[model samples]
Target chain A: MTIYYSEDHEWISVDGNVGTVGITNYAQNALGDIVFVEVPEVGDDFAKGDEVAVVESVKAASEIYSPVGGKITETNGELEDNAALVNSSPDGDGWFFKINISDSGELEGLMDADGYKTFIAGLE
Target chain B: MGAVNNDLLKTPLYSLHEELDGKMVPFAGYLMPVQYPLGVMGEHNHTREKAGLFDVSHMGQVVIKGNNADKWLETLVPGNIIDLKPNRIRYSMFTSEDGGILDDLMITKRENDIFMVVNAACKEQDIAHMRSNLPDHLELAELNNRALVALQGPMAAEVLARFASGADEMDFMSYAEVEICGATCLISRSGYTGEDGHEISIPAQKAIEVCKALLSEQEVEAIGLGARDSLRLEAGLCLYGHDITEDTTPVESALIWSIGKRRREEGGFPGAQIILEQISNGTITRKRVGIIPSGRVPAREGTEILDSADNVIGVITSGGFGPTFGGPVAMGYVDIKNSENGTDVFLKVRKNKLEAKVSATPFVPQRYYRKQK
Candidate 1:
């Protein structure tokens, strides 16, 4: 499994043709308390960089974009009842959706874990 | 984006907020803490359950003195300033000639002068308005050297009583001059949050000392602007720029109660003609109403309000998750016909239309401390 990060602060962990996506820990921290989340339905097709989800914190709402072109396979429905999982575990059980990758080449545009660390470091 | 804006002014407790890991954000031309490590929801819940200390130094504090101060003030606001007893506080607004609200403020009649607190964003204009209209004998002076802070919640009275004698005994909307941390502080048993609290105006030099002492209390925790917003929203308090703006009238905003009965009959304030006409004829086209979204989705400010047929009827002015209410709570202006309690409204949040209902507010029952007879 390989984890890639988007400039928008979304993270995708790719394994085979499937990739699990969620916001990074840094993104969750900046968003304050998670109150509501609107996830994409399963089997919804999206192109790279399309807005696929929305995360609403106490302050404001933020959009989550598709890291790469893909069709959503599953969504973390647990968020509908308890959105704080995104704040407690942004990378693990807090995952937003699973996408079946449409193009392996699109993953090249995202940053590796090491590169993402550097990118986030510069943000501070 | 993490870098602080050098142009923004810093309050006296800025360094203390930084040391406490507060996330500083630009607000009303000042570098104010939006939240601390506890986050907005936690801070809001803590404030409701225990007590939370807030640094409100950014708000504008001013003193009005000299001859006929109350009479002069009565000309600007619709509240009955003449009848307001010394040490009593009254919520009022400066209305425009056209019945639009200029700004909402707290007026405390002191021994020899009237102390007023206005919104930070509208302070300059409010001061200029008062100054330009002042008579030769009247004086309006801004309290530039004071830092205002609020200790709010159910435990607030107990925590404050430890530092200042007679703190807990003060009635709601009453004021007193008390010595806290060796400084003469103007303490008022009033706050935007629905919970029992006191807003203390301390000398700028003694702000940190007083705040530190308050935070040392077992029941008190440092809260930030984020929680303050949610707390006030749940309290059914209006935010100046959002819920009540220059374009909104007090009658339309459902703040008609703040206007004294005498003022309603004898019109004399800026917008007397227009506001009084609206009062007598019930001509307010739009009225503010409390809204509770049926689902978890928050219908944020500017979201269009629609009827069952999808026709736009109103707009949400303030909306967010109410941590204490355990769901989404909002306040907005709707057509008078659709402003009845329990009226169903649809909120256009993005492309999705969320179901919501018009309900009465102080989403959580107000817990203000009022002395019983």
Candidate 2:
């Protein structure tokens, strides 16, 4: 429940270096209906802004950017089988993957829960 | 020139789509519904198992009225048009004199007018073609602003029967003038999903009333372009830009059924010589077969189909994971010999040769109602 946010609309909470990440509800609503989820393999390292995943809705394919420099520790295997979960619970059970953050200091630049809420609200 | 002002193309049911949280996309210059919150696969499966409604307002509606309308139109298209009964629809194609398909269209005979529907993107060209080719006595009235909707799936007729009284009386390919929700419009018993459904053409202002009346039924749900694509694919129907084009002749695309018996023997429309010759002598090559990828990965358009020896034989036209079929399906051209029912083939997918097989079309069986009478 240690909600940390990325400018890319992804968020995570860390238990030591191991953390869970998923897109905000705003991203899911904007994407409109998750049809397919393309996830990177476990142990794949990614830098911020690197395309780590692909989510396809009905008409378009959206790229999910890495929220922080991290090594993939685990992925939501359930999404591979049931992509619709991302649409139903984007923030909770639909968390895309678990990444082990390579640097905890990166959190200093990320948005807090209150700041992300304000940022999202301003978008409308 | 219209200057591509898309704001004018909104349908009467636009607000309803927004209410259902439909994702909009720009198609044929109109802000259109591509999918609802359920996405393409879900909507497609729902249509197969239940029912779906579509806003097809982009299609062109035209009326050809004159003493010689039928006789004149017969010269342009390759259907038995002059023989169509007053209320029946006949599927036909406008041919270039050299035998290329200019465009495919549907024609209906009214008391004093011959009404027509053409693809949304090609309407301007179609009207222009008809105007120049048709003599001065024949008048072409383009109803470009009308809105059309297609109620599809097995339960479609049941839903439409509530508002359009006496809807069940019509059979497949039949249409008539019907009053729906206190509005007069043309309702046709034809659709692109290869199912027993109806295509309703109404004035732009009255379209929403019809949509509301149909949506009132618990069995009806609004569908978008995403599901529309998959449903048509599952039905083995062709999309204009993907499955067909002007450069591709009708013979090679396996559209011989559209060519009538008399036209085949008499040879009057465009490209009659080449078309008739190919019919008997066999097309130099034919578009045939379907492909199902082994994995969940979908082979999109332009993906190469190869033989065991790695020979690029054909190109994939339309490919995606079908909701009803429960797997990825693709349609493409293949050599006639390898186009048999169960031939093994391979598709090149992102550095991997995925196992695929040539299978017959309509991966999901169509559920359309038909009446003998």
Candidate 3:
């Protein structure tokens, strides 16, 4: 149940071949309020760095990149109506989409919690 | 951080905000609070449902006094300042010789001097403009040491009434000096958010105490510049940098009514000729409306707005997802024909044509509280 983070501030929790994806808490903090989450439809496939989700705040809108190659297995319908759930629980219930990882090897490119903490610290 | 930076611009409540765990951001050359511990969304929703306390201490507060106060200000801007009775506020724009917007500001006629509050980023320039143009007898004093806090939302009056008795009784666009949080201040029943609210101008040192005092109420939380943008946007209120600028005129920006009838007829202020002409003939271009993309994409600033045939009609001046509206909205100058309320439009997001509709402003209905009597 460990979380991995992309440099772009998206996070994924891996279990076997599945990765539960959402923006990091840091991303939510930076984004102010979550007004919209433009999630890809289930079965949509994207390569790493492809625009998978669009997260918006009151002031700005930003693209959420897929940290790894994957086929979207499920999209968080809750975000469609209550995007602020991402601001409240970015790590758990606020997860954006579930993707079946085409290559777990891509996880190597992402960072773990400690690494993500260090990365956020380095940002300061 | 201390009050003075290298350039010495300071928000009156700078240190107070820091003490309250506010995240200070460098905005328009001044260090100001963008949010507090409850966060931007919480703050924004709180203001909508209850009340939000904003440290608008960065805005420039000036006192223009003398027998010719109205006369001098009138010459510089084509607004009816002379008609502003004491305890009333007016939304006016500073105009250039050609009738372009200098900046938008609030002018309140107090018991004594005329209290003027201009945008934080444009404060220095506005003060300079006033000083250069105002007659010598009409003195300008920069009240730089005061804090301006806006208590906005539906419950704003209820929260302020606890401290300032009869605050709820005040009508829209009215002001009165009251004592609260152990400080004397000017309280105005006005706000950028199209809601019932109050903007309190308190002494610098008492800013934090007043904020804390307001926070003592369960309904009040500190909102940052983030929610401030959304609330104002939902109200269709113009932001100086995004919606209005020196190159944009009042008529073109769809704010001709702000030019008081007296000013329009007097025709003595700066840029009166062009403004009056534009008012009569109508500006060829108009600032149109834009709603959120029905698709899962955001149309940001500088995104091109296109007509049905894919011809570029205008550029987005301000576009963002409104938390309250549950979608994105934007404003921009389009051809006059496309400025109608129900115009069909598309926003070009990257390579995709995202569907958008030209909608009326105040996307949310204004809930301002005016006295029944």
Candidate with top TM-score is 1
Give fnat (model 2): 0.25
TM-score of each: 0.99, 0.88, 0.89
Higher-DockQ candidate among 1 and 2? 1
State residue A65's C-alpha deviation in candidate 1, in Å. 1.0
Model 2, B142-254: lDDT tens per residue?
88667899998888887788787678667888888888877888989988886778999988788887787787788888899878887787778777767777755678767
Q: Which stretches in model 2 have alpha-carbon errors above 4 Å?
A: A58-60, A100-110, B1-8, B16-21, B37-42, B97-99, B286-288, B335-337
Candidate 3 chain A: 10-residue stretch with minimal lDDT? A53-62
Best-performing candidate as measured by DockQ? 1
Error of 1 at B10 (Å): 0.8
Q: Score the docking of each candidate (DockQ).
A: 0.89, 0.35, 0.50
Selected candidate, larger DockQ, 2 vs 3: 3
Q: lDDT per model, in order? A: 0.94, 0.80, 0.83
Clashes of 3: 0
* Cα-based lDDT at residue B15, candidate 2: 84
Candidate 3 per-residue lDDT over residues A13-93, each given as its tens digit = 888899999988888888777777778889989999999988777667788999989899999999877888998899877
